[model samples]
Target: MPQSAVDSPDLRLTLRVRAMRREARDVLSLELDDPAGGLLPPWEPGAHIDLRFANGVERQYSLCSDPADRTAWRVAILAESPSRGGSRYVHQTLRVGDLVTVSAPINHFALTPAAEYVFVAGGIGITPILPMLAEATRRGIPWRLAYLGSLAERMAFLDLPQLAGGDTLLVRGDLDTRLDLTAWIGSPTEQTGVYACGPERMLDALEQLSLDWPRGALHVERFQAKTFGESQGADTFEVVASRSDLVVSVDRGCSILEMLENAGIGVPSSCLEGVCGTCETAVIDGAPEHRDSILTPDERESNETMMICVSRSLGDRLVLDI
Candidate 1:
């Protein structure tokens, strides 16, 4: 079957499991193959695919392989009780040759050139960081990887240390001590870029520490997003999708994007909580609330940018060029 629209428009891709491994107690490295073609769509670092299940549940997982590797895309799934069912399905029911529909890789977090890069990863978060480490290594970019795992035995990648070469720093929390990210991310110089992916607490700490650094110096990808502040704080507004000639009420409980979608207006979106830039649209009029994490304050102030995922309008209404 084709991995895209002709076969399944909803997800746009498919993964026929080629290999699997017991990375940890509850984590597994699943190597997925292209459905029919030689390779899948090209992607960059920090890209992710939305995995769809037979039961109709869809969840996103970050691509764990180097984007340059077109043969297959790798992802690590960790089973958790509160899982919305995506990880549980992959960890338990998914088999070596089973086919799973996946979406084209979409990237919101991308690597930028830095004199020095420090990657802080915790447990399953290490998957995405592995690709970046490989890219850095290939380019001879000076970098350091601080990986924290529950135990040496439970660390997913057995080849992690070897892959990172001499720049790798593995911290086994089950053995020595809990990691102090502040000591690792220290005073950020102009040329340094700090990239981290892990638990919410780790991300929060990184965010707080990054406040003192340059605006774009710290790059982060959180699997779970901090929710957008409710629209009650927003002024009740209207949005006119000029092209559609649709006027939608941007109410206190409804976002402009939600209103549009509810009205059967389709706007490309992923990670609707505001981290991914998929729902970004051009604002023709009215000041935007700028609730998304992807855009800078300056970009938001320009009114040329808007993240429909969470941001709403400031005044009576907004006129979007969409």
Candidate 2:
């Protein structure tokens, strides 16, 4: 299948919750399977699926299970106290045997070929790294892990057999030991690939510290939307759908997505906040003032695509491959 098909919003599968188990405090691991006992779509490490709830709420969760397991897909979710209803619904309302609509696994954070790997995960961020550990082990690649949590009891999947080794460091908040990124992440080398998933503060620190590192040496996945510094002062712009041969004017106060919908053009969108990768349209012409958290600095420089939900044209007109 095409990459676009894999990322398409119209692609949805109804799967049954085969089992649910509590992994840690306020965290639950759910196993989803095809009700017909058939094989599910294959996924690589760092891929996530969008879970559509009955109440029309949608949330993305990273696949934590081994990618080799085609029979089932597993995701661990943390129940946030002030959740926008996604986590709470999974924790309180969702139950085993209930069918849920899930999208195909889409990976913006994919594992690249490297001689060695270094992984740093904080709290629930470890979910995506779990599968990466398995893949590295299978390929016999040298790897190390630093897993951090508030407490020992709150750290999920610590008891997993794969985590047993001297290379794996388990740090807790209540203890005196702390995660020092400066000390843990030394000067990045060409042979080493650094992957980190954590809170905004931790990611921010890592991003700043790795500035001098070799390009593409440091990779990160954020659980929250990035705080785009300062507004760009919104201005009216025009968008031309290359394929549709349609033109739409986006007002200063309105978004391109809103204007597209008004023109009867349907685009897949989930989190309109630019945190989710949905509504990412291919750019045929013109520069875009990228506002999405999912794209990297290099990707923004390429100008090959833009998330229409929050991003706008840098010039007066933008040509999109709709």
lDDT of each: 0.76, 0.85
- Which parts of model 2 are misplaced by more than 4 Å? 1-10
Model 1 lDDT per residue over 128-224, tens place? 7888888877777788888888788777785754354537777887786876777866777878877888887777788788888887778778777
Model 2 poorest ten-residue lDDT run: 1-10
TM-scores of the models, in the order given = 0.89, 0.94
| Alpha-carbon deviation at 190 in model 2, angstroms | 2.3
- Indicate which candidate wins on lDDT: 2
Best model number under TM-score:
2
Q: Candidate 2's residue-wise lDDT over 1-322, tens digit each?
A: 1122224646888899999999999999999999999999999999988888898778888999989999999999998879999999999999999998899888988999898899999999999999988888778888899998988777899888767532798898988478787887777798888888978888888889888888778888877888886546348888999888999998776788888878878788777777668788999999899988788778889999998888887788999999
Q: Which residue pairs show collisions in model 2?
A: none
* Candidate 2 residue 4 C-alpha distance from true site, Å: 13
